[model samples]
Target: MDLFTYYRSTSSYRVRIALALKGLDYQAIPVNLLRDGGEQLKPEYRAINPQGRVPSLRTEAGRVITQSPAIIEYLEERYPEVALLSSDLIVRASQRAVAALIGCDIHPLHNVAVLNRLRGMGHDETEVIAWIAHWISEGFNAVEQLIGDDGWCFGASPSVADVYLLPQLYAARRFNVELSACPRILRVEQLALAHLAFQQAHPDAQSDKPA
Candidate 1:
């Protein structure tokens, strides 16, 4: 397997966490998001993923999978020994919901593409930064209300929800979103850092991390 990834991509980070938790080893194919007018957008990469996204995973036998959620779901289904979802149906649904809350809801609004689109529309840096902060705070409010205060999002083990949440927390800090009110979320973030999977998947640990 080969993972086409960019260091700072939150979506890519989620996949890395899932892969590590599954105890899978794959070749890291770095796609520098900041070099040569963004490598993901280049013709060579577009052929690999027309969407030009950060995470494009090619299976060992050469099946390309795009989108973080789909890739994680595939991993969960294909490699079930270390399940990322809860056994209980309701709990599993809740786990997926939290993951989507961040992945589908919050991150999309703050991703580099969206910000660049905002810039193209004549939005200034101040306005763009404010936009990112506003969206993250709004999302964190929902997360704070739902997630428990502990090391994990669901139980003793980190679920798909935690895989998703940690990356957004990274984004929150990057955008300077105040998380003081979200004590549970912050607590989980602190605990997650101590875990090997999370640490291994951190942006700083990526091969593409800036020097």
Candidate 2:
């Protein structure tokens, strides 16, 4: 597998964590999102993914997959040995709810495109940062209640919820969203930092991370 990724991209980070947790070996193809006015917008990358997004997975058979959620779902189904979702029906739904809450509701609000649009609309840095923080704090406040109190988000083991939540938590901290109110999330963060899979998949551990 070849993973086209940007080190600091939370979407890429989530896929990395999923891959690591599944113990899958793949080539990491770094696409620097910030280099030369964003490499993802270049013709070469656009050819691979017309949307020009990072975290595009190319399988050994030369099939390419896009979108983090879809890629993660493919990985989860393809490699069931390390299940990210629960077998129980209700539990699985709850886990997916958390994933949607972050992926759809929270992450998109602070997406680069959204922030850039805000800037284009004449919103200054302070306002943009505030926009990022407000949504993250609001979403996380709900996530804190949805997840488990101890260990991973769903239970003792990591789930799709944890896979999704951790990346958003990273983004929250990156935007300096106050997290004192989300103790459950903080505890999950601590656990994830200690987990080998999460450690290996972290943005700082990626080869393309800046010096």
Candidate 3:
């Protein structure tokens, strides 16, 4: 299997964590998102993923899977031995809810594309930075309120939600969101940061780290 990913993409980071947790062996095919007007938009990479997004996974069976959530669900289904989703229906729904909070609700607003669009519309750095902070704080407030003081999102074991949460949290930190506002998340993130799976999957730890 080959993962076509950008070194700093949060979506790619989520998939990497999933792969590490599942203990799967795969080749990393780095597609530099910032080089040459973003290689993800180039024809060669677009042939692999027309969406021009990072984390297009080529499975062992030679299928091209796009979208991080779909790819993760595929991994969970194919490698059920690791068991990312909860067996209980309500618990699983809660997990999916938390995952969607980050994946769908929070991330899209703060994505590079959105920020670039803001820039194109005559928004200055201060405006763009405030835009990112506002949306992230909105999402983080919800997560902070719901998370409580637990080791994980739902149960003690890390679930699919954590996979989504961690990367968004990383992005939030990059934007300088105040960690003190979310004690539960800060604690959980610290624990995840210490774990080998999270450490190995960090953006800086990737082979294509910027010099």
Off by over 4 Å in 2: none
Query: Relative to the unseen true structure, what is the C-alpha lDDT of residue 66 in candidate 2, on a scale of 0 to 100?
Result: 99
Query: What is candidate 2's lDDT per residue for 1-211, written digit by digit as tens?
Result: 9999988888999999999999999999999888898899999999999998878999889999999999999998899988999999999999999999999999989888789999999999999999999999999999999988778888889998999888998998898899999999999999999999999999999999989
Output the lDDT of residue 210, model 3.
Answer: 85
Give the total clashing residue pairs for model 2.
Answer: 0
Ranking by lDDT: 2, 1, 3
What are the per-residue Cα lDDT tens digits for candidate 3 across 121-171? 999999998988888889988988766466787778788988998999889
Candidate 1: lDDT of 115?
98
Cα lDDT, all candidates: 0.92, 0.92, 0.88
Compared with the true structure, model 1 gives a TM-score of: 0.98
Candidate 2: Cα lDDT at 25: 99
CA RMSD of each candidate after superposition = 0.9, 0.7, 1.0
Better TM-score candidate (2, 3): 2
TM-score of each: 0.98, 0.98, 0.97
Indicate the residue-level lDDT of 137 in model 3.
89
Error of 3 at 141 (Å): 0.8
Q: Which pairs clash in model 3?
A: none
